[model samples]
Target: MSIPILSILVFLPLAGCLLLLPAWNCRRLARPIALVVALTELTLALWLYASWKGLAVNPFPQGFLLLEDAPWIPAFGIRYTLALDGISLLMIMLTAIVFCVGLAVSWDSIKERTSLFLSMMLVMEAGIMGVFLALDLALFYLFWEMMLIPMFFLIGIWGHGRRLYSTLKFFLFTMSGSLLMLLAIIALHLLYAQQTGVSSFQLQELLKVQLPLETQLWLYAAFFLAFAIKFPLFPLHTWLPDAHTDAPTAGSVILAGLLLKTGSYALIRFGYPLFPQAAQMMTPLFYSLALIGIFYASLVAFAQQDMKRLIAYSSIGHMGYVAIGIAAWQPVALSGAIIQMANHGVTTAALFCMVGMLDERAHTREIAAFGGLWGKLPLWSFFFLLFAVTAMGVPGLNNFVGEFLILAGTIKSSPLVAVLAFCGIVFPLIYMVRLVQEVVFQKERQPLSLNDLNPREIGILAILALLDIWMGIHPAPLLEMLHVPVQLLTGGTP
Candidate 1:
C-alpha cells in the first residue's frame, strides 16, 4: 500500500541513467543530471535515517528494517527481497554522499567520454545501493557482481599508465572471489531445500537451516575468501595498490569510498551470522591476519613514493583495524568496526581526492614532487592536514573514536591484539606526518605554481572535514543506532 521507498532508492539512479540517454550528446547536461540523481538518493537516505525508529523500540526482526519482500520466483523460491538496518542504512548513506562528492569533484576533471563515465558511476551507485538493501542471497550476489562491470570500464578506459593490466588484475581477483561466493550460495540454497523441502535464497530463511560444523567451515571459507579479497586483507590485498594507483580520480573515489566497505559489510551481515560456529573457530586466524595486515600495510605505506599508492596502502591498514574489531566480536568492537567503516570511507576518500587534485595540477603523485604548498594553497593544506590527522586517529576526529573503541574492545578480548594494533598505529603517524611535512611545510623542490582549491573542491572537502569532526565530537547518535544491532550480532542483551 505504501510507496516502495526502498525500491525507489535502489533504482532511482538507474532511472536517472535512462533519462540521460536522451541527452548523451549534451556534455553539459550529463554531470548536472548525475548530480541531481545522486543528491536525490542522498536526500532519501537522510529521510530514512531521520524517520527510523530507534533500535531499542523497533529491534529489527532478524537484523533487518524497512523491509520490502515479495515473491519474484515462486518455482525457485528466490524472492525480490530488500531490507535495511542501522548498518545498511549507514552504508547506503555513505554511498550516496560519496557518489555525490565524487561526481562534484569529477565535473571538470573528466572530459573524455564524459557521458559514459557519469553513466557508469550512476550504475555503480545503483548496484552499491542494492547491495546494501538486498536481503536475499541471490539478490545480494547479483548486486555484488553488478558493481564490478562499471568499475572495470572506469579503470580500463579512463585510468592512467598500466590501466589495462591493473583493470584485468582487479577484474580477475574480484571475479574469482565472486564465483566462489556464487558456488557457496547455491550450496546453501540446496542444503536448505534438503532440510525443509523448499529451496530459497532469502537470508532469513536460510539462517534457520543449520549445517554441520564441517559444512559451516567450508561455506564460511568460501564467503571469507570473497570478502577478504575485497577487504584486501594482507596477502590477498595485492590487487589494491594497482587498482588505486591507476584509477581515474572518480574511480579511485568510488573504489575507496564505497566498494571496499561492501566487503566488511558483507562479513558482518552474512559471514558471522550464517556460520557462527566457523566464525568462532576462525577468530584467532582472523585476528592474526588483521594484525599482520595492520603492521605490514602501515610499513609499506610509509615507504611509498607515489602519493596515491601510499594512500592505497594506508587503506589496507585502516581496514585491518576493521578486521581486528570484527574478529574480536564484542559489542563495542563491532560497533567500532561499523563506525570505522564510515570513518575510513570519509577520511580515505578525502585523501584520494586531495591527491587527485594535486596530480591534476602538478601532473605527478610523487611525494618529493610537492613542497611549500602550505604557503601557496593554505586552504588545501589545512584540509589535507585535517584529513591526514583524522586518518592517524588523532583525538577529536572521526578516526580516533572508532579506533579507540576498537582498541578498548580488543584489549578486553585479546590484549596481545590490542598491543600489536597499538604499535601499528605508530607507523601511520610517521607516514602521515612525513607526508604533511614534505608536501605542505618543506621548501619547494622546484618552485611550483599551484592554485588553491576551487569552490567545488573546497565544498567537497569541507563537507567531509565537518563530518570527520562531527563524528569525532558527537558519535553518540551513530553509536546508539548501532548499539542494539551490534549487541544482537555479538549475542549480548540488547
Candidate 2:
C-alpha cells in the first residue's frame, strides 16, 4: 500500500503541537521542536517536488493524484478524506516554505508564552495543510475554521497596540463568512443527498450533482462571500492592514504568505469549478473589483507612513492581479494567477520580515523615521530594495513574469481591462520606487544607529530573494505542475 503521505503531512504538525504541550515548562525546547517539525515538513514537501514527474495518464477515480478516503460519520456522509492535486501540492509546498520562514523569524521575537506561541503556529499549520488537502467538504470546513482559533490568539495575545481591536474585527469578519459557507456546505450536501439518494460531502461526488443556474448562483455567492472576505477583496480588505500592523511578525508572515492564498485557491479548487455558470456570470464584477483593488490599494500604500501597513496594502494590490487572472478564466491567466500567488507570498512575506527586523532594531515602523539606510545598513538596504522592486513588478523578477502573463492572458479576453491593469502595474512601481528612495536612500532625517542584516535575518531574506530570482528566470517547473490542472480547468494549454 502506498504511504498515507497526505495524512502524515497534515497531522504531523498537530502531533508536534501536542508534544509542545508537555514542554511548557521547558520553554527552551519549543523553538527547536517547532523548527524540527517545520523543517521536516519542508523536507517532505521538497521530496514531493523532486519526485513529481507529472500527473498520471490515467487520473484517479476521485480525480486526485493522491487520496485517502475513510468513513468518519456514515450518517452524514462526512468522511476522513484527504486528496491532493497539482494545485494542492503547490499550496502545501508554499505553506511549508512560509511556515518555515515564520518559525525562523519568530525565533527571538516571541519572548513570553514561547511554548504557546509555537503551539498555536503549529496548529495553524496543520489547519492550513488540511484545508489544502481535504476532499471532504465537512473535513474542509473543519480545517477552515480550525485555522482561525490559532490566528485569533496569534493576533490578540502576542500582538502589539490595538491588538484586541484588530483581533475582534478579524474574528467578526471571518466568522460571518464562515457561517455563510457552512450553510452553503450543508445545503449543498443535502441537495446532493436528495438527488443521489445517498448523503455525501465528498467534493468529487458533490461535483456530479447538477443544480439549476439559480441554485448555483445562490450557493456560489455564499462560497464567494466567504472567500472574498478571506481574499479580503477590495472593499472587504479593511481588516488586513490593522491585523498586519498589530500582529507579531510571524502572524503577518503567515497571514500574507499563506492565509490569503487559501481564498484564491478555494476559488480555483472549489468555487468556480463547483459553480461554473455562476462563475461566468460573476466574471465582470470580479474583474471590476480586482481592478479597483489594484488601483486603490496602490494609492493607499503610497500614502502610508508605516512600512508594515504599506506592505500590507501592497498585498491587497498584488492579490488583485490574482483575482483578475481568475476572472479572466483563461489558461494562461489562471496559470499566472497561481504563480502570482506563490511569488506574492514570497515577496510580501519577505517585505514584512524586513519591516519587522527594522522595527526590532529601531523600535518603530514609521516610514518617516527611516532614511539614508543604504549607508548604515547596506546589506539590509540591498535586500529591502530587491524585494521592494520585485513587488513593484519590475522586469526580470518574480512579480514581473506573473503580471506579464496575467496581462497577456487578460488582454486576450478584454482589451480594455487589460489596458487598465497594465496601467495599474505602473502604480506599484511608482509607490515602490518612492518607498525605496525614502526608506533606503534619501537623506537621514534624524541621528540614529541601525544595524545591518545579521546572519539569521540574511538567511531568511536570502532564501526568499533567491526564490524571487529563480521563479522569475525559470518558472517553467512551477508552470509545469500547473499545466495539467489548469488545462483541465480552462480546457486549453496554460
Candidate 3:
C-alpha cells in the first residue's frame, strides 16, 4: 500500500504543536522550532505539487489524488477520508507558505507567551490543512470548526485594543453560520439514507443522490450562508474589519491568506457541485451582492485613516471579485477565481505583513502618522508600493491577470456585471493611490526616527514580490493545474 502522504501533510503541524509543549519554557527556542516545523510542512507541500505534476493520469475527475478512504463509523457510514485536487493542492501550498512567513514576521514582535503563540499557529495550520484535504462532509465540518479555537485564542489573547469585542464578534458570526450548516449536513445525511437505504457523508457518494430543486435550494442556502459569512459578503462583512484591525499581525495574515479562501473553496468544491440547479438560479443574486461589496468596501476603504482598517476593507473588495467569478460559473471565470485566490493570498498577506512592520517601528497604524516613509524607509516603501500596485490590478502584476480573466469570463455571461466590476476596480486605485501618496510621498507628520525593514522582513517580501511578477507574466502553470478541475466543475471545455 502506498503511504498516506495526504494525512501526513495534514497532521504534521499538529505533531509540531505537540512537540512545542516541551519547549514552552524556552522562549528563545520557541520561534526557531516553529519556523522549522512550518518550513518542513512547506517542503512537503512542494513535493506534493511536484508529484502531482508528474502524474500521467488526471486524479481530479476520478475525485481526488492521494485519496484515502477508510471506514470510521460502520453503522452511520462516516469515514476517515482525505484527498487533494488542483484546488486543494494550491490552497495547501498557500497555507504552508503563509504560515511560514507569518511565523518569521512574528519572530521579533511576539516577546511574551511565545510558546503558546507558536503552538496556536501550528494548530491553525493543521486545521486549515485538514479543511483543504477532507473529502467527507462530516470530516470537513470537523476541520472547519477546529480552526476557530486557535484563531480565537490568537486574536483574543495576543491582539490589540478591542480584541475581546472583535474576537467575540468574529466567533459569534462564524459559529452561528456553522450551526446552520451543521443542520443542513445532518438533513442531507438523513435524506441520503432515506433514498439509498444507507447513511453516508462522503462527498462523492452524496453527489450522486440528487435532491428535488426545492430541497436543493434550501440546502444550498444553508451552505451558502455559512460560506458567505466566512467570505464575509457585503452586509455579513461587519466582523471582518474589526477582526483584522485588532488581531495580531500573524493572525491577520492567516485570516486574510487562508481563512477567507476556504469560503470560496467550499463553494466551488461542495456548494455548487452538490446543488447545481440552485447554484444556477442563485448566480444573479450572488453577482449582485459581490458587486455591491466591491463598490461598498472600496468606498469605505478610501475614508479610513487607520492603515490596517483600510487594507481590511480592501480585502472585502478583492474577495468580491472572487465571488463574482465563481458566481459566473464559467470554466474560465472559475479558473480565474481560483488563481485569484492564490494571488490575493500572496499579495494581501504581504500587505498586512508590511503594515505590521510599520506598526512595530512607528507604534501606530494611522495613515496620517506615516508620511514621507520613503525618505526614511526606502526599502519598506518600495515593498509596500509593489504590493499596492499589485492590489490596484496594475498590468504585469498578479491581480491584473485574474481580474482580466474574471472580467472577460463575466462579460460573456453578464456584460452589466463586467461593467460594474470594472467600475469597482477604479475604487481600489483611488484608495491604494491615496494610501501610497499619504504614506510614501506626503511629508512626515511627526518627528520620529524610524528604521527600515530587517533582512528577514525583506526576504519575506521579496519572495512574495517574485511570485506576483511570475504569476502576472506567465500564469500558465497555475491555469494549467486547474484547467481540468475547473472544466469538470463547470461542465465546460478547457
Candidate 4:
C-alpha cells in the first residue's frame, strides 16, 4: 500500500519540530532546517495542487487529493479520517506558501533563541495542516488547540514589549470561546450517542444527526462563538490589533496569514452543515455583522500610523467578505469567499512582510518617517505598491476577482449589502493610495538612503505577485476545486 501523503505532510513538520530536541545546542542550524522543512512542505503541497491542476469545481469530490482515513480508538468509535476536497486543498496550499514566506521574512532578522523560534513555527505548520485535513470533530479540535501552543510561545518569547500580556490576551480570548465550543462538541457527542446508540466521531455519521430546532440553535450559537471570536468579528476583534502590533514579524505574518483564517474556515466547513437550519435562521445577523466589520475596520485602518495595526485592521475588513460570501449562499459567492481567503493569505502576508522589512531598517513603523523612498529603495517600493494595490482589491489582481464574486453574490442576497460593501472598497482605496503617495510617490524628504528588497524578499514577493496576477486572469481552476463542497453545503442543484 502506498504511504499516506496527507499523513506525511502532517508529521513531517512535527518531525522537524522534534529534531530541535537533540540539536538544541546549535542554534544557527535551526532556522536553516526550518526553512528546508517549509520548502519541502511547499513541494508536497504543490504536488497535490498539480494533481488537482490546482483547480476546484462545484461538487468538490473530484478535486480532493491524497485523502486517507483509518480507525483510531475504536472502542469510542473514533476514526483518523482525513480528506482534501477543494476547501481543504486550498488551505493546505495557502499554508505551505505562507510558511515559506514567514521563514524567509524572519531570515537574518530574528536573533535571540533562533532555534526555539523555528521550532514553534514548525509546530504551527503541523497544527494548521491538521486543522485543514482532519475529518473527525474530536481530531479537529485537537488540531485547533495544537496551533495555539506554538503561537503562544512565539508571541510570548520572541514578541516585543508587553509580549506576555499580548500572548495571554490572545490565549484567554480564544480559549474563552473555544471552551464553549468544547461544551457544544460534548453535547453533540452525547446527542449522537443518545440518537443512534453509537459514540462515534465520524463526520459522515454526524451529518445524519437530526436534532430539535431549539437544540440546533443553541449548539450553533456555541460553535459560532468560538469561530467568531477567532474571526474576531466586530466587537470581539479587540484582541487582534494588540496581538499583531506586539508579535514578532513572523508571528504577525502567521497570525494574520493563517491563524485567524481557521475561524472563518471552521464556519464554512463545520458550522453550516452541522446546523444548516440554524444557519438559515441566522443569516441576517451574520450579514449585519459582516457589513459592520467591513466598514468599521476600514475606518480604523485609515486612522492608523502603526503599519502592523493598519494591516491587522485591514485583515478584519477583508474577512468581512468571507462572512458575506458564506451568508450569500450562492455558488458564485462561496467560491469568491474561498478565493478571497487564499488571496488575503498571500497579499496580507506580503504586506506584513513589508512591514517587517521597514521596521527592521528604520526601527519604527511610523508612516511619516518614510518619504522619498521610490528612488532610494525602488525595489521595496515596487513590491510594497504591488501588495498594497492587491490588498485594496485592485483590478487585474486576486482580490478583485473575489471581491467581485462577493458583490455579485451579495446582490442576490441583499442589494443593500451589495451597495454597502462597495462603499467599504472605497475606504481601502483612500488609505492604500495615500500609502503609495506618501511613502513612495512623494518627493524625497529623508536622506536615510534606504535600500531596496534583498534577494530573499524579492523571491517571496515574486511568488505572491505571480499568484495574485494568476488568479486575476485565470481563476477557473480555483473555482472548479471549490464547487462540490459548496454545493454540498447549500443543498442546491449543481
Candidate 5:
C-alpha cells in the first residue's frame, strides 16, 4: 500500500491514455500529452533506479518491488500479481527509453490519428512493462497478449508497404505460440496444485514446485516453443525479417530493442531454472540452432537489398549469440548472454533508428540508393559510423565487452561452440562496413537537403553512445549485479 510505485509505472500509461480520449480540438496538445506521459513514466522509472542504487540488497529475487497480489480467478487459482527484479529492472528501463524516444521520434513522423497513435504507444509501453514485472503466470500471459495488440495495430495502421501481410503473419505466428504457452501455464498451475494442495499462480510458489522430470520436460518444451518463436530462433524466425522491414521506425525500435528480450528473460527467469535438467539435456540441439541462426541470418543479411531487412536479419544473428551464450550455462557465458541482450538492444535499436532516418530522408532503404552521403551529412555520418562500429563489436564500444564476455564465458563451457561462434564475428564487420561505405562514401547524389540528427535524436543517440562506451570500459557494476543471479540460476553461489 506504500503507493505501489511499480503499479504506478505499469498503469500510469493507461491513465495517460485517457487524456487523449476527448480527441477533439486536442491536436495541438497531442505531442505535449505524449511527451508528458513519457516523461512522467521516465521520472518514475528513474526514481526506481535511483532508489534501487540506495538499497543494500536486491529485493527482487525474493520477489519484485512494490509487490501487489490478489485473486483474479479463484476457480483457476490464478491471481493478479506483479513485481520486479534486477532482470525486469533492466527491461523496464529499456521499455521506458523506447517509449520516450518513440514518442519524441514521432513528433514529426506520425500525422494521422495523432492522439490514437500516442495512446497505442503508451499502452504498448505499459503492456511490456507489465510483462517484465508480472509475477503470476496469468498476469504474465495477460501482459504478453496485451503487447501483441498495439503492435499489430501499429503495424496495420501506421506501417509502410505491405504492412497488412506482415502484421497478420506476426499476429498469427505469435498468437499460436501464445496459445501453446497458455496451455503450458495451465498445466504448470495444475501441477503446482496437485503437488502442493494449495493452488496459486505466484511465481515464488511455482518456482518451488518440485516437478517430476517427465512433466518438467514437457513443460519446458512447451515454454521453450513459446520463447523460441519470440526469440525467432532459426526455423521459427521467418516472421521477424518481414516484421522489422515493414514496421515503422518506432515499431522497429521496440521490436528489436525490447520485444526480443522477453524471450530470453522468460528462458532465464522461468525456463532454465525450472527445467535445468531439460535445458542441460537439450543444450546441444539449442546450441546448434543458435549456430545455424548466426551463420544463416548473417549470410542472408549480406544479400539483402533493404537496409531495414538487413538490420532485421542482423538481430536474429546477434540474438543467436545470446542463445548460444545461455546454452553454455557457465557463469561467464550466462553473464555474457545478459550483457549481450542489453548491448544488442541499445546498439541495434540505435542502428534501426539511424536507418529509419535514411529511409525517411532518401525514401529508400535499398543499399544502392545512396552514394557519397558523407559530404552531405557529416554529423549523421559520424553517428552512423559510431553505431556501425558498435554493431560489429569494435574494441571501444560496449558491444565488444559483451561479446568478449560471452565468448570467453562460452569457451569455458564448450570450446567447439566458442570456435564456431567466433567465425560469425567477421560477418558483422563485413556487412556493417560495406553498408556504411555505400551509404556514406559511395553514394553519388546528396540527400536532398537532408540535415543531420536534430537535438532530440542526438540526445537519444548520445545516451546510447555514452552507455556503449561506459559499459565497455567499466562493466564492473553490471558484472557484480549479474554474478549472484547467474550463479544462483546455474546451481552455484556467487
Candidate 6:
C-alpha cells in the first residue's frame, strides 16, 4: 500500500503545534519552529503536485487522486477519510503558501505571546488542511469548526480597534451558518441510512442516494447559507471589513486568502454536486447575489478611507466574480472560478501583507495618512503598484486570466451576466488607480522617513510577485490540473 501522504499533510502541522507546547518557555525557538513546519507543509504540497498523475483509473468513484480511509466511529457511521482531487490540491497548495507567508508577516508584528500565537497558526493550518482533504461529511465538519477556534483567538487577542467586537461578530456569523450546515449534514446522513439499511457519511456514498427536489432545496439552502456567510456575499459580507480592519495583518491574510476560498470550495465540492436540480433552480439567485455583490462591494471599496478596509471590500467584489462563474455552471467558468480562487489567494494575501508593511512602519492603515511614498520606498511602491494592478485584472496579469475565463464562460450562459461582470471590472480599477495615485505618486503631505522593504519583506513579496507574473503569463499548468475535475463537475469537457 502507498503511504498516506494526505494524512501526513493534514496532521503534520497539528503535530507541530503539539511540538510547540513543550517549547513554550523557549520563546526564541517558537518562530523558527513554526517556520520549519510551515516550510515542510509547503514542500509536501509541492511534492504532491509534482508526483500527481491524473486519476485515469481512480478506485474511488468520486474522482479523488489520493484517498485514505479508515474506520473511526463505526457505530456512528463515521470514518476517517481524507481525499484529494485537483481542486483540493490547488487549495492545499494555496493554504500552505499562505500559511508560510502568514508566519513570515507575524515574525515581528506579533510580539507578545509569540509561542502561543505560532501554535494557533499551526493548528489553524492543520484544520484548514483537513477541511480541504476530508471526504466524510462528519470529518469535514470537524475540520471546519477546528479552524475557527484559533482564528477567533488570533483576531480577538492580538487585533486592534474593537477586536472583541469584530471577533464576536465573526464567530456569531460563522457559527450560525455552521449550525445550519450541521443540520443539513445530519439530514443527509439519516436519509442515506434510511435507504441503504446502513449508516455512512462518506461523500461518495451520499452522492449515490438521490434526494427529492424538496429535500435537496432545503439541504442546499442550509449548505448555501453556511458557505455564503463565509463567502460573505453582499449583505452577508458586513462582518468582513470589520474583521479585516480589526484583526492583525496575519489574521487578515488567512481570513482573506484561505478561509474565504473554503466557502466557494465547499459550494463546488458539496453544495452543487450533491443537489444538481436544486443547484440549477438556484442559479438565478446566485447570479443576482453575485452581481449585486460585485457592484456593491466595488463601490464601497472605492469609498473606504482605511487601506485594509478597501482591500477587504475588494475581496468581496472579487469573490463575486467567483460566485458568478459558479452560477454560470459551465466547465470553463468552473475552471476559471477554481483558478480565481488561487489567484485571489495569492494576490489578496500579498496586498494584505503590503498593507501590513505600511501599518507596521506608519502605525496606521488610513489611506489619507499615506502620500508620495514612491520617493521614499521605491521597492515597496513598485510591488504595491504591481499587486494593485494585478488586483484590477490588468492585461497580462493573474486576475485578468481568471476574470477573462469567467466572463468567457458566463457569456455562453448569459450574455447579460457577462456584460454586467465586464462592466463591474471598472469599479475596482477606480479604487486601485486612486490608491496608486494617493499612496505612491501624490506629493508628500508632510515629510516622512519610513524605511523601504527589508530583506525579509522583500523576499516574501518577491515570491508572491513572481507567482502573479508566472500564473498570468502561463496558466496552462494550472488549467491542466483543473480540466478533468472541471469536466467531471460540469459533465462536459472544458
Q: Cα RMSD to native, each candidate? A: 1.2, 1.3, 1.1, 2.1, 1.9, 1.2
lDDT of 3 at 7: 84
Decreasing lDDT order of the candidates: 6, 3, 1, 2, 4, 5
Per-residue CA lDDT of model 5 for 308-329, tens digit only, reads: 9999999999999999988988
- Model 2, span 390-437: residue lDDT tens: 998888899999999999999998999999999998888888898899
Residue pairs with backbone atoms closer than 3 Å in model 2 (clashes): none
Better of 2 and 6 by lDDT: 6
Q: Give a tens-digit lDDT track for model 3, residues 95-128.
A: 9999998998899899889999998999889889
lDDT of 6 at 404: 95
- Model 2, which residues run further than 4 Å from truth? 54-59, 492-494
Give, for candidate 5, the lowest lDDT window spanning 10 residues. Answer: 56-65
Q: What is the TM-score of each candidate against the true structure?
A: 0.98, 0.98, 0.98, 0.96, 0.95, 0.98
Off by over 4 Å in 1: 54-60
Q: Which digits, one per residue and each the tens of the lDDT, describe model 4 over residues 142-206? A: 89999989999998888897888999999999999889998998888889999999998877778
lDDT of 3 at 232: 76
lDDT of 2: 0.91
- Candidate 4: C-alpha RMSD to true structure equals 2.1
Residues 46-148, model 1: lDDT tens digits: 9888877753355458566667989988898989999878888889889999999899888898888888999999999999999988989999999999888
Using alpha carbons, what is the TM-score of model 6? 0.98
Error of 2 at 449 (Å): 1.6
Q: State the C-alpha lDDT per candidate.
A: 0.91, 0.91, 0.91, 0.86, 0.84, 0.92
lDDT of 6 by residue, 280-381 (tens): 999998999999999999998989999999999999999999999998889889889999999999999999999999999998878888898999999999
Q: How far off is model 6, as Cα RMSD?
A: 1.2
Residue 400: error of model 3 in Å?
Answer: 0.8
Evaluated with lDDT, which candidate comes out highest? 6
